[model samples]
Target: MKPLFMLLLTYLLCWQVSLGQQNSYTGNGQVTFSAGAPLDLIKGTSTAITGSINQVTGKVYFEIPVKSFQFANSLMEERFNNKYMKTDRHPKATFIGEVTSFSQNSKEVTAHGILSIHGVSKRRSIKGTLVKEGGKFILKSGFVVSTKDHHIESPKLTGGFMAEHINVNLHLQLIPENVTPQVATVYPAKKGLK
Candidate 1:
């Protein structure tokens, strides 16, 4: 089921690019989570993030594979996916929302939408900065997610190993489909040297 979800996301990303729609951008993105308890520090990151944005509509979407997140320690990673996250049951996290008050002149923007994780969906708002450069849109944002809100279990045995609130950071560089030149289907028949 996880593989199927990933495949579908890939297909959608490709479709978004192939459509060649104006003001639409898509790219591979990154997400990171960090937290600290009294005794233990928890940190993980996943680069296997697929995302897209439609500037015209101020809409954005992101899909992240739970198994893709990596921790510094193998045992921690194992426990995260198997015990805490239960990746087998809920293998992916997704977000879909609209960027409110988005404007080409404004560097800061607010996004409001649904964030689904651990089989639970919750309304969330994120604040971030956007910069357009070299034909790419670079976005950065930070938000907090509560473990209890998503029904994530915190075992007593793992005391002080996890924090109640998780800090999530996002960095995305997106290329507009319309601005990218299409690959030439057929090379111009060898041009004769003048």
Candidate 2:
């Protein structure tokens, strides 16, 4: 009985240590962006974020390809891709920076990163919460953006129908041992994307 008890205690101690000090810097992430006008406006989300987070230094960075955006209406999707976003011209919008502050044992962090859209990059300061659980990193970061700033002009048909200052929301779930996330071409790919 003594030997059994000692083994169990040692196992528990090892597990706890592994959860803490064994923190890793390599983790996957995601990005979600949505824009709505008045009525009949569409929203969307994407997961093409790729980057790393250093647990010790509290630095994190990620990237999401511009080609992963999906829309509710098929025609709208094409218009957004071929006209508004011009994904062919701008392939990616990346975020890179360090987490300046966080609470101890809380697992929630406030990270600051830069946002690059179109062929232009801007200094975007973002504040969000993070959790390291199930051997993965989950982040929810959101910000507002001006369509004109990124050169996102309304399509010819949708012109005068959309808003200039659009609100974007991002919810990223980065799972471990997972490969790159592809365009979610499933049913209603555009509903509530961002």
Top-scoring candidate (lDDT): 1
Compared with the true structure, the alpha-carbon lDDT of candidate 1 equals 0.82
Q: List model 2 lDDT by residue over 1-194, tens digit each.
A: 54456666666766665555444445444555656654557565565567666666776767767778666778877877777778899887777788887875775566666777777777767777777667767777667888777777844325556556656666666444323322223233354563
Give per-residue CA lDDT, model 1, range 1-194, as digits (tens).
54456666666776666665758888877899987663566789999988888877889998999999999999999999998999999999999999996656778988889999999999988889888888788988899999999998764334445467888998988887655434323223344532
- lDDT of model 2, residue 14: 60
TM-score of each: 0.76, 0.66
RMSD of each: 11.2, 15.2
For candidate 2, the TM-score is 0.66
Candidate 1 segments whose C-alpha is farther than 4 A from its true place: 1-20, 103-106, 155-162, 178-194
